[model samples]
Target: MFKMKSKSTLLLMLLGAVVGSLGVTSASAEKARIVNTGKHVDNLIHKVDIRNLSYFDTRFDYSSKPYKMSQNRYQTYKLKRSLKIANMNKHKEVILPKGSVVTGLNDGKGNITYISNPSLSLKNQKLVFKTLGNWHGSLPIIKNNGGAQQPYTRNTAFSYKSSAMLPFLSVKSNKPFYDAEGLSLPFVSISADSQLIYHTKGSKYKPTRYAKIKKFKLTHSAITYYLAKPVKGVATKKVRSGKTHLYRATFKMGHVFQMMFADNDTDGYSLTVNNGRQEFFISLYQLGWKYVGSIVGLTGADAVSPTDAKIATDYVQGLY
Candidate 1:
């Protein structure tokens, strides 16, 4: 009887051991599968011409000013695009976290706009989205120079609005970085009171461009903005065949967000934009990370007064 009881105990222990091993193996395999799948998707995207697979839905009002006090109206635009990342391996739909939805807004002028919330726009239509995940990332930084990666990036809902207009494109930040040093990143706003009116290179060339207006109805939101350089364009065609034409404008990837991309990496505060135009332009002062406050307004170096310039500088420098 004693021998039989001892055998039964040994069998049960062995069974428990087997189950534990299997659990570990299963978890490891699942992780590997997800990694491999992500890699496969990346590779396929590289091989394909992204233009063929991607489409953007855009809507905006055309006007000549940022704030239209005469009409009591504001100019705006909204576009949403789904980039099909081709993958050979099957991928489960990735549901981004509550803050993972990436969004952007830009005017055709010098003002870049970011809308943190999608549902706030009263003028523009909602973006046509299929997959999950917003345009989200942070500025990149190296380890040796590490301090608190200041202006940490966060997923905030916002609405975008601005007066700047130029060719622009959205990009992902390669590493953790901060914007005060002056690297170009996406600029955004919660609502735009400005409108892109004209594109002028010289007295010889000019085009009358305007944006349709939209209004956002949200109360709380966030905005991100990006600056675009190295624009591409083709000379405009002449119908009369006598006058020299302007050009058909286009833009390429200039720079991504200055904020470094990390998981809740921001220690202080930072800013970003969501949707942008192909050819957007802006001044230097407006090109840094900004934080939105509840009562005061947008916070950043610009928001900081002359008295607080030193404080803002120190705060930005500490981000590095």
Candidate 2:
């Protein structure tokens, strides 16, 4: 009997040992899973957000009206040798494309004169020529109306100019000119050697009058801005002190954001944040000095990783 009792106690001790071992194994597995999940979250948070910088201020105000992001106006044009001359006698009027440049005109005579000044008209398509000399017959007018001979064919050889005109006196003043009204104008070139001044005109007017003989000193003070190098990865963290918090908000994954700033009085810059699939835009007076925000497109309720949020928040704050 004493031996049997001792054996029973031994059996119970072995069973307890086995149960304890199983419990330890299960707990270890659960702990390991939690650790791995934490690591994954950290990785997602650190992932970089792609950034594209632009010199144009692409932010718009939509407080009173529904906001719509502007579509890209960039076009691809194929270069062609010659364009069809418009036959005015057929009562056929050809309007040039908005951005087309007229380098030369068919003087309504047989001769095509390669003149220095070119006119670019944005609104009208009719190519009308003020006769320089009576040919006694209708001349062959080169149709500069913005028709693509073939799809995407653009003749850039002609000096193309913007339709918006700047006052001749303002350009000659040699002082920095700002289109306070945000008007787009053609590039103006003043001759350093002669009093000849040339500007771009549209096909609506005569080509010869495009060039002007005016006296003005050459000034190299014209100001322009170019796009800065794009930044990759998330924004760094830096806190700024101001009355308004520029970029303090929760954003979901795939949300897009843009920050626009004026580097100087004459130049502007834009920073775009492409998060997941959604895009958002923000236009600021100075980096973070003053700003207005808008939605670039539709967004959803997907939560973004903490790291991405931090990176984006820190980047905008760093700019300030």
RMSD to truth, every model: 25.9, 30.0
Q: Residues 162-241, candidate 2, lDDT per residue (tens digit)?
A: 11111111011111111111111112221111111222211212222222221111112111111111112111122232
lDDT of 1 at 249: 22
Error of 1 at 138 (Å): 37
Model 2 lDDT vs. the true structure? 0.22
Candidate 1, poorest ten consecutive residues by summed lDDT:
17-26
Local accuracy by lDDT, each model: 0.22, 0.22
Give me the runs in candidate 1 sitting further than 4 Å from their true place: 1-207, 222-256, 259-271, 276-310, 313-320
Error of 2 at 218 (Å): 20
* Every model's TM-score: 0.18, 0.20
lDDT per residue (tens digit) for residues 71-157 in model 1? 101122222221222111213122222212222222233121232222222232122113222212111111121111111132122
Error of 2 at 29 (Å): 81
